[model samples]
Target: MSIPVITLGAVASAFVPGLEQLRGPVTVVRRCEELAELVAACQTGLARAAIIAPGAADLTASLVDRLRFTGVVIIALRDHPPGAADPVVDGIDYVEASVEPAVLAAAVSRAVGRFEAESARPRDSHAYADPLGLPDVMVPQPPDATEEPGTGRIVAVWGPSGAPGRTTVALNMAAELAAAGSSVLLVDADTYGASVGASLGLLDESAGLAQACRIADQGRFDGAALGRIAVSVAVKGGRLRVLTGITRPDGWPELRPAALGKVLEAGRSLAEVTVIDRGFCLEADEELSFDTLAPRRNGAALRCLEAADTVLAIGAADTIGVPRLVKALAELDDAVPTATPRVVFNKVRAAAVGRAPETQLREAWERFGPSVRISAFLPMDHAAADRALLAGTALLETAPASPLRLAIAALADVPAAGDTRRRRPGQRPRNVKFPGIPARLPR
Candidate 1:
């Protein structure tokens, strides 16, 4: 039986005549003039493979992912070698447009064979496998046979909405770790409001994290590639490797969970501690409304939490902030039951609670919050925070003796057990019970 194929665009049309002439291995089932028609044809199960031109309308990474999800192989015909001007799409096989019909047929057959093999294999529940079945072409191997790969600790800084000092905590913690001679990679994964670049005085508009995700989605992510994309910022104690977040909110689709997960994996091999500043929302409502394969806006934050060795759940100290944090903690427990986040209350002050604030806050937490323990309380220091913000640096750099800085530095001492218990790629995190909270909180 001949394998059915669809062709799109003028370049793809030129090959149809030759492909039909040699009809033993494959057959041209349809010739689509536009991307929409090609997508429709593929969705109807009319073809197993699509030969698309590079200039196909609305041929984005998301579209490519959707097409691949339908069990269709995409062969993108490239007019020339990929460069900065014309980058390669993530989940497509690029073949030289001038290749002969025989070569194209063989390529399609090989791709199909590999796809079938991958589909038959049992997939890991925690991570998504490359849709294209591409090998890890650029993964760095350890030099000595006896030496193990670097298993850096992943610390994710998360919080509820209303500016609860997530970025402030993440930046200082990473700086302190770096100051203590540990290599650190600070990633700004906040899709909604990405200000890590501007916060640290990095004026460059390049979306480092997005670029890394694209490289990761292509199965070519490595420590070297990460280094190339990330910018180095020198701090008081040491320098930090920073991966800035997306410049625009619409770029959330670029930070797919699967790709971001791979980037975190590579980050472990690159640094001693990887600090990620995550977004506020954890809701996966998109999953309920859209297909299982749709791009999730909050998937990036959830994925970071899942991969994190330690989760620093930050919240403000005010009346509104405390309740928000408590509610968010319950949601966090439901989202990733295995995650035991270290609760941190930022901007803590006597005014927020009564005099003797720590004692009052503790009593309230025990009554209203889940059974999780409070990790640290960062006192509100507006002057110090302002200085750091104005200087575009961490508190350690601006005011080392500030009370808030001291509090944030102490958080660095928390052990990262993930270094020792490195979960295998795509392996689900083992279920570890939270001390007091039940597996599922009352909704």
Candidate 2:
């Protein structure tokens, strides 16, 4: 098969003669001078491989990612020794500037072979069907896809952009799991804005999450090291370990994917249940920090959703919240497409959704997202929130019997016969009745 190729910059002149000799074998279909042209050429399927000078105008990581995503293999001309391509600027095979034309031809052939190998991988395995049997679900693909038959489940709590009370839900879930005698580990993983520690009045001085990431980065992370980083927080009848998030957003780069993955696997090994409280943002740009393999702020959230056995997707319950929730689910369809997330409504009130908000919400969700089922409903309790915030702890510690805590605890015991409402063939579950709010959220 003829491998169609493209070239940019003066490097093309050096390879054109050799490429001429192999014209029938390797076709130089396009000679692009501008980076934009290169992007367009790759995007429009004009070429399958590219040889670019490092000095090509506007050559960026984003462009490389787009090319790679679209099945175009890039070969960057580098000054490095020619054993293998440099991993720094992703999707590019490098050859020394002064390499022989034959050597350059061999490099192009090697890049094509490598590209074919990668292209042949089972990427479609990550695509799952939505509840309605719609084909566009993008679930996070695990590295070692061989899932064990029965392991203690990991539930990642994620919400939309707004403050939909994800930390509140995650804290109480971990606490509930602990009280049930399941060893639980509560992780605060918000890179943009972390409040799990603040919610519990935990200290902000020591960086537990960052420290764990550092140890994990060095390949020395373990359960014992996990204990060293995490702080023991007292709950109703037991204590659970909590790994606080980074002190600031600037520290997000430290939460590298390799490091974070190790921590997650280790958490499951230690705890019967691990509840990771994540941030709202879930953008997955494979080219993020492509040069150094640095972490993006949203990487942790994306990884959490993918790694977890289940996802607890929390959203606001008001009018704005409901519509936002619908849009968020649609976006999630593109992000973690294959994940069947259990949606929870937080801050449900009469002012925003009118009387019998649950009924209105149920119909709206059924209309907008036939496949997304409302799993749990938590009421807005300003007093309970205030008291817990003021006391520097979870609702279970201060307002255990409050409606809010009760609703959250119910969610924590999912699939336990009476705790959850499963969707039947033609209707909502029979035994479950969602708790409602007596008052609305005060201004």
| Top candidate by TM-score | 1
Per-candidate alpha-carbon RMSD to the true structure: 12.0, 14.0
Per-residue alpha-carbon lDDT of candidate 2 for residues 283-302, written as tens digits (9 for 90 to 100): 87464232333446777777
For every model shown, what is its TM-score relative to the native structure?
0.69, 0.60
Please identify model 2 stretches exceeding 4 Å from their true place: 1-150, 286-290, 293-295, 414-432, 435-443
Model 1 segments beyond 4 Å from truth? Answer: 1-6, 9-34, 37-150, 285-293, 414-443
* Candidate 1 residue-wise lDDT, 370-416, digit = tens: 89888777788999999888877787766776767766765675222
The TM-score, computed over Cα atoms with residue i paired to residue i, of candidate 1 is 0.69
Worst 10 contiguous positions by lDDT, candidate 2: 434-443
Q: How much lDDT does candidate 2 score?
A: 0.69
